[model samples]
Target: MAANFGELFLTILLIVCLTVSSQGREMMEKKYPYLRLASSFSSAKARGYDYIIVGGGTAGCPLAATLSEKYRVLVLERGGSPHGNLNVSYLQNFHISLADTSPKSPSQAFISTDGVINARARVLGGGTCINAGFYSRASPSFVMAKGWNLELVNESYPWVEKQIVQFPELAPWQVALKNGLLEAGVSPFNGYTFDHIYGTKIGGTIFDKNGFRHTAADLLAAGNPKNLRVLLHATVQKIIFNTRSPRPYAVGVLFKDENGRRHKAFLHAGRHSEIILSSGAIGSPQLLLLSGIGPKQDLQRLRVPLVVNNEFVGKGMSDNPMNTIFIPTKGHVEQSLIQSVGITKMGSFIEASNGFGQSSDSIHWHHGISSAEIGQLSTIPPKLRTLEAAQRYAKTKHEIPREAFQGGFILEKIDGPLSRGHLQLINTDIDTNPNITFNYFKHPRDLRRCVYGIRTIEKIINTNQFSNLAEDDSYTINMLLNMSVKANVNFIPKHTNDTVSLEQFCRDTVITIWHYHGGCHVGKVVDRDYRVLGASRLRVVDGSTFATSPGTNPQATVMMMGRYMGLKMLRERLGRRAGV
Candidate 1:
């Protein structure tokens, strides 16, 4: 039986090469056959949408494909449709869509009350369909200090790098993490570019070259599919407004759809009709304090109904606190994510990932430790530790075998974290999770930029381009970065060690590189033409109008600020109907 017919002809040639690589990602989602005329929420309501966008994710699908190329947009999306999600179309199942704790997961897990767990990006190409897709851009002094128009942010980052960016072929552990970040001085190598340039470059990836991903809902195939609609689970939940004069306005939104039914949508009589939110950065300030628009004593202690008190709608929240290291390799590396970064002019960026596997029912372990036993319990001696003695020495160690969970991690984060926090709510349930608190490193210059980015990842694993990841070539991962370089810093605050400072090991290993942005910032809650200050036709474009967390991954400047604020609100509505 000739080796059982050569193992059934190599499992039918690996299922015909994964069905011809999933029909080349379904021929790029069949070049948007109008994204299957996206409906649902029980086939939507009597249409009236000259722009109603809200969280279709990653700057609301390029701001509803540049306001559907001239108004009539709608998009709503509350997860569903990363079209045939093989964990969002396989870049080797990227951490199975962020360890999918499914309740219709598209990566939504939350935690932060500064205890930090963090997730949020319920699909619809939001967080670029559960990120790791590392595209870069932003940092021409963060587009001339956010007053933008650096030639329309360089022509809106090549119209989103010609639709969901790519350029990544690197993998050989990202060429030894880009020769261990230019042998750790993090210099010169500007090799590839999406330009946020500082040093060790490579950046750009929405994951293609066969590992397919390309989201921001594939830039909605550059819109105008008869003025786009896109509905999917559709959650919105508030922001109706029109509060009878003294400046209130906004006139639409109150969603629900995935059969919890309730609708509403408005804003069509064009006086440059609006209602955008691009729901991110904790869903545009938790839908502006659940539509009462914040702080009148947290909308009268949650008995809601105020419209505009504006105590900076959920104040300045921030996140970018990451701190990894992990590495492991006794051999075979290859698999990747975040093609080598390392920007660091002391504000810290440094990135990496190579070989990410997971799935032993998403192998989570806090008290059971193992991520190389919490990177060998951060090499002990910080006054005889305590995370209950590193969980009893990672519970007498010894696990690591889900096929040796191969290597990767190295991260570092820290940029622009003037350590802020606030986002309260606790209820108003448009799918709960509010009380955020990114108070990490509560500013000591963000713990000296996370101990100078963990001493630049301990000089990028003592360079010599990480001397073939130590199988006795002795870079013993710098003895697990001795006092700091955490093991994915899985939330350490519990009677944390008082000193032996790497600033108390960056306040006992903070974590969250989900690159959190402010609550609704830009001159405190939308101004500079992103509207919303005291309200009108309300606006708040993504990353809650970021006050910092731009380059090195803020999804290509949040999909080029949703196509440069939808081509600057279609040139401020054709320059106010040609009156300009």
Candidate 2:
């Protein structure tokens, strides 16, 4: 009896020890709340979500993170995850990401019908995954102009900044660029703040100390993972609508997985359940048009079944047109993206990137300049049509020496461009890239502003501060300007002082900074609450709904819109419940 009792006691002790050890192991193993998938997300069908967000880019990621705190959320991204993509996570690969042409690459390269070459992100983080990583708050004037609740917008800025924003330790090249801007009278030197001000300011960046980029995807860390489901490579084809009632309601979305397998994700039958289109300027409008929610004439032309006659769906497309000035340095400069910005009173923003534009052979400079045949477009006046004709005549005769170090400054017209462009459907196919026409420099004021920007960059390079780093002389400037022009055609430099030549130069050299916005303007396509006009349970939370371009790098503003909209939706739900 004593031996049996002792054996029983030993067995019980071993079981207790094993149970405690197992519990400790479980505690140490961290399981993220969100379920991430590359394909086969059919489980989304079984469990309907409270919120279904399309295009898991900049705006969608943060919005999902915030909304998931209270509601079940699904983010369907058309591209792959940026988590392990070096081209997306590293600051040095900034241009390389944009230059990537692989079909599966996150950055989808496209040329506008007007002949401008640019790229839009197809990744989970959207533009933040591919952009220069510059971060800044929208100007107060912009917030007020949009009639946004300033208090709410202010509250939302910190939520995004805390996760991704970082003050860059100025690289040597950025430091030199800052001095040059100040010497050239950019003024006031707003140090380290994210405020959008007219001066030489060192703004925030997304790149961290180790040079790893912290994108909008990081914001998901603050979310309830169990409430959020992020499906990557899930391309949304169209929004499924129920027109049984007078007002058409977006009930769900039809998206395709990586294997081109179709999947349907539906919003729960809850009172506040909604489908938000945060697919960005181009993607949002394109998706809307594809779903037959655009101009009646356009929808009829494409033989799409009409859902709404909102003519403003794909109109009012505006992008910040940039004119770049490249400078070749004798000594090597540390490679950096946008760090210091020269916000000029002249209605243009001047910013520089180091170690880019080093190779004339790179796609950003070579193919970008050559393939853009803006001359064929009818938007240009007959007089300046010679500028387009010049594209065929211009040729890049002298390539910059491979050993020569190079840096360049970009002049962005951000105050408010007078010219407005449009995006139209080429077909009903969701996979096909839309026809984008950025009628650049259609207005005379836009042309004058770009010319002023180029001259201002010239002044900065000529300043004593940049003299040691830049080639200063009319000959050098003219040669560099001609090189940019000739990349489009084989034209010779003529009448360098004449306004016609300068205007021609502006027309030929201008490219998109990719701050495109306003295909779904607030007063036109969507209400102030960002809900689509003449529709129910649908909203646009990306740059697509901007009234006008905010005069800065727009990533911060786009994220703020997502945050602001997410909170506003929550408030609206509460108000409804209270019968307010």
Candidate 3:
């Protein structure tokens, strides 16, 4: 049977692409032809390598690919390979794997605790394998908006986008959604958003003909590098550390391959040798602690002698409190809308200049505007601006001021912000899953703020700007005013200045959108340069180092960070040799 509806293609591709996992017995035969894991560990194994990268994930895959250009690089992946897996090739088939019900092998496994949020891929490709194909670049305003230098991120954006092949337009069958928002008073912002951010008026999805998700896995496959060795279904249980001088240095990695036997893999970082930890956020810290580089208390608990007393190593934990508003429209809209459109084939019309439709691929970007621009829009009601901006935005393509977007418009985090969660060992046994608590909505402001944000969304949806056109005669534009919905709505906890409907949404409706971040944050675990402050010759390169949470999806930004760090490592190596 052919696709029943349009959105199915996008929905399917978005689910499966480049997921990486441990190369276990379950899938020893189902890997890509070019890459394979080591069968058995040899004590006297060949150890002369320019660099050894740990954790083949969002950061690992890219780092391995980039460093291989000049150095002999070895990527240690704990998961099995899903390379050339057909369930992944055809977009429709990808959704099944999203189930993650494939019984995990001792050597190969992936942890999916939430229905929507997939933790990390225990496969050769990492999260790219299972994440919905929502590839978005870092917001420019998000970059230049503050913190890191603007020019550096600006330069890196082009570099990473080119490597990842960030799509430029919506796939065929996807509605412009831009038109639906004319009533909402929003506009197309040069950044990334869901298929559509504005109500009634939304945006389109980006995709290709075959509809395969294009993640780092695809990028590496395309590069076809010669010397890159990707070890799949291989688990790195510990990092061999040396503490003769009272400071431990990571000199090697202890891993278990498909057969469940242990092997010692050494890191030779002298003169031309080094080890870069590009492991996904969770894996990075665990490996570090296994190697004895995490918090002192954690290391002691595991009976693993600590080489460093970095309390912040695994403490800064933070994941974006990302939640979605599923407005069930009258028809089978999700499927019908997607199957009807493609990126380049669709019309360019949109509502807000800062909303959607202007750029086919990304929904928003950093417009690099001024404080004056922000002040100008400050007084304008968010709902009216959303409606007018979205309508005017659909007419043509133009850049909107990114600064005006400084504080995001997606405000549903009503209660105090959730406190950061921690990752602790549930069992010292490396194979056992660790204890991870996100401590969601722990802060009082989290519920309140989220409630407030939703109100804003409701206001936009209910306003005359939206109701005038969206409401029906049976339902006065006033009837559609959401008064009934609002009346029945409970934004906070009841019986005590709070409510229930919103509470359920807070506790269950939201989770990290595969964007878990800042576990070993800057100023706490590792320095801004991503080096473990107290430990020498050890560093983290994944999302663990994210200083603060990025309000949007973090793949492009994190991958670029890997690239940037790779270059910095090389340049610094050059400097150390030059005797500067």
Q: Model 2 over residues 195-304: C-alpha lDDT tens digits?
A: 99989899899999788998887777777787888887888999999988899999899988888888888888775788999899899999999887999998999898
Tens digit per residue, CA lDDT, model 3, 1-580: 3565557876666554323234443354344433666564455866655677777776777667766666677778777655556544434443334433454421122222222233456665566665544444444444554356565555555665665443435421123233323334434332333232222222222234445555565445532256567777777887676778666566777788878878777666674465677777777777777777777777888798777777766665665454333222222211211211111101111111111111223333211111111111211222233324433443422343222222211223221135677777765676665655566666655665555444444544454543333324453434333431322111222222245565555555443345566667777777777777776666788887765544234566666676666656655666436321
lDDT of each: 0.73, 0.75, 0.50
User: What TM-score against the true fold does each predicted structure earn?
Assistant: 0.34, 0.84, 0.68
Sort the predicted structures by lDDT, highest score first.
Answer: 2, 1, 3
Task: Kindly list the per-residue Cα lDDT of model 1 for residues 172-271, writing each as its tens digit.
Answer: 7778878887877789899888888888888888888888888888788788888887877778889898888898888888887766768677877666
Cand. 2 Cα-lDDT: 0.75
After TM-score superposition, the amount by which residue 87's alpha carbon in candidate 2 deviates from its true location, in angstroms, is 0.9
Residue ranges of candidate 3 with Cα displaced over 4 Å = 1-34, 40-45, 103-118, 140-152, 168-182, 188-207, 221-226, 269-272, 334-418, 456-505, 575-580
Clashes of each: 1, 12, 113
Candidate No. with top TM-score = 2
Q: How does candidate 1 score on lDDT?
A: 0.73
